[model samples]
Structures are given as C-alpha cells and as structure tokens.
Target: MTKVPNVFFICGNGLGSSLACQMEADDVFEEAGIAVNSGHDSISDAPSLNADVIVSASNFRSQFANTQIDPKTKLVYLDNIVDKNEIKEKVLPVVKKIAES
Candidate 1:
C-alpha cells in the first residue's frame, strides 16, 4: 500500500478563506506526485486528528500561545500570502523533507 502523508490544517472559526487554501494544497501535492491527505479543522479538533504534521493558519501568534505542541509534529505557520502558487512554493520545501525522509 502507498503511504500518504497526513496533514491537519488548523484555522480559527473554520471555513471561509482558510479552508479554501487547504483545498489548493490537495492539487499541489497531487501534481508533485505525492499523495497528501489534508483536512481543515479548528484547534479544538487538532488533537483528535492525530496527524503526521500540523499546518497552522490561525495566525502566527495564536499558533504558539498557551499550547503544548508535540515535538514530533512538524508544525507549519502560514503567512498572509494571497497567491496560492506562492503559498505552495513556500510550503513545498517543508513537505519535501517530510516526504523524502
């Protein structure tokens, strides 16, 4: 069986623009010839997902605020980049490392 990386996308309030960006990530991974299972959810749901990595889009400050993050988890803090391609470019390096390793 092929192994696909599990990515949990965390955002505040859920839905709206944040969820849309995550959907784009699906296509990006697809074109890269790597299958990634990305899902959008709130911080409260993060623990239950048991994801391989956590991608935070709930603003930079909140990502590390009053929270204990798992050391093994690869956390990604997304900046305010509107262009989907640019965002993908920035995130690709991190994804590549996880995939290669």
Candidate 2:
C-alpha cells in the first residue's frame, strides 16, 4: 500500500485560519489522488505533528525556521488561506512529487 502523507495547516491557533485551510487542502489532495491524513494545528504544535508537509500563511513562514521539523519536509507558504486555486498552485505539485517518490 502507498504511504499516505500527513499534511498540517498551521496558524497562530488551531481553531480558525488553520481550519479553513485544512478544508481546502482536503479537496486539493483528494483531486490529485494523493491520499493524505491532514488536519489543522497551532504553530507551536508543528514540530510535534510530524507532518510530511507543513503549510501556513506566508507571514508565518519565517517563524518555522526555529522549529524542530525535519529539514527534508516540504513547507508551503500561502498568500490566501481559503483560495483553492492558490493552494493547488503552491501545494499540488510538491504533493505529486512526494507521492511519486
């Protein structure tokens, strides 16, 4: 069986923005045939999530630099959290490559 990737959408808090992004991520991953176990979390929980890919608002990209996440994991910075088009553009290609590997 193919290993499903773990994708986490993170924000200041796990409740709001991250939740919105997670919804979009679900649809995007489903359409790409990239089976993913995804969810939302606070930025503080990022390192512990062990996500194959970490996604956050563009503004928070710098903050992840100090986290303990693996250097090989993909990081996606999005300008719009709820924009499926933007998510597809920034995230889908990387996910496809990961699935292939």
Candidate 3:
C-alpha cells in the first residue's frame, strides 16, 4: 500500500484555527476515502514540518512567500477553512495526485 500523506493545517498560532481546520479536514478526507496523517501547527512551524501537504487560509500566502519551503511540498490555500465543499474541490485533487505519486 502507498504511504499516507502527512498534511498540516497552519494558522497564526497552533492553538485555535489550525486545530479547527484540521478537524474539518479529517472529516473531508474520511468521506473522500483518502487516508492521511494530519496535524495542526503554527505558521512558524510550517517549513520544518516536512509535510507532504500544507493547508491554510489564503491570507498566509505572503508569510510563506519569504520562507524556503521544500519544492515537493504542496500548498493548498482556502478562503473558508470550514467549508467542506470548498475543501473537497480544492484539496482532494492535490491529495489524489500526491497519493498517486
């Protein structure tokens, strides 16, 4: 079997928003039959996480712009973190591709 991808949900602080988004993403992945190893972390911890995928609100785009992220890591930006439909539409495809790889 292929290894499950490690996905991290990033926010300003590790405490609130990232955790909430991670919870919602868990449900979305389960429904989509995608198995992932997921977690929540602050933006400061992002580059070091070495995740296959990193997800966060679009506002963090500028913050990540200056960071040296791994070329293989896939970033997914969402306008609404709790929106399942949006998550499915945006995140699922990247995850499917990563799984295939």
Candidate 4:
C-alpha cells in the first residue's frame, strides 16, 4: 500500500497562522484525494515533526534552513497564509509525486 504523506504547516508561534494554513491545507488535500496526515507547529518544533512536506510562510525560510530538519522533507513556502488556491497549486504536485513514489 502507498503511504499517506505527512505535511506540517509551521509558523512562528503555532497558534494563529499555522492553524489557519493547516485548515487550508486540509481542503486542498481532500480535493486532490490525497491521504495526508498533517499538523501545525511552531518552527522550533519542525525538526522533530517527521513530516514529508513542511509548509511555512516565505519569511521563515532562513530559519528552517538553519535547523536540522530531515533532509528528505520537501519545503514549501507561501506568500499569503490565507490563499488556499496558491497552496493547492504549490502542494498538490508534491503530494502527487509522493503518491507516485
């Protein structure tokens, strides 16, 4: 059986922006028929999330780059936290690739 992809939506605090992005990600995953295990967490916790994909605001790229996050994890960045369409555009392809693998 193919493994479901795990995705993490990260933010500075893990309370507001990350939670919102998680909700948006859920919708995109559902529409794509992609079985995903997803969660929201602070950037500090990202190194330990064990996710296949990590989504975060564009500004946090430097922070994530400095961490010891798994080298295999695909990093996705969004300019707008509330733009579900953009999230779908960026993430669906990654999800499909994961499914194929």
> Candidate 1 clashing pairs?
none
Compute the lDDT of residue 17 as modeled in candidate 3: 85
Candidate 4 lDDT: 0.89
Query: How far out, in Å, is residue 19 in model 1?
Result: 1.8
Q: Please estimate how well model 3 matches the true structure, expressed as its whole-model Cα lDDT.
A: 0.89
- Winner by lDDT between candidate 2 and candidate 1: 2
**Candidate 3's residue-wise lDDT over 10-70, tens digit each?**
9999879888889998999999888999999998888899799999999998998987788
Each prediction's Cα RMSD?
2.5, 1.3, 1.0, 1.0
Instruction: TM-score winner between 1 and 4, please give it.
Output: 4
Best by TM-score: 3
What are the lDDT figures for the candidates, one per model? 0.67, 0.87, 0.89, 0.89
- Candidate 2 lDDT over residue span 1-101, tens digit each: 46777888999988999999999889988887788888899988888887888889999988888788888789999999899999999988877777667
Query: What is the Cα-based TM-score of model 4?
Result: 0.94
Residue pairs in collision within model 4: none
Candidate 2 TM-score to native: 0.91
Counting clashing residue pairs in each candidate, in order, gives 0, 0, 0, 0
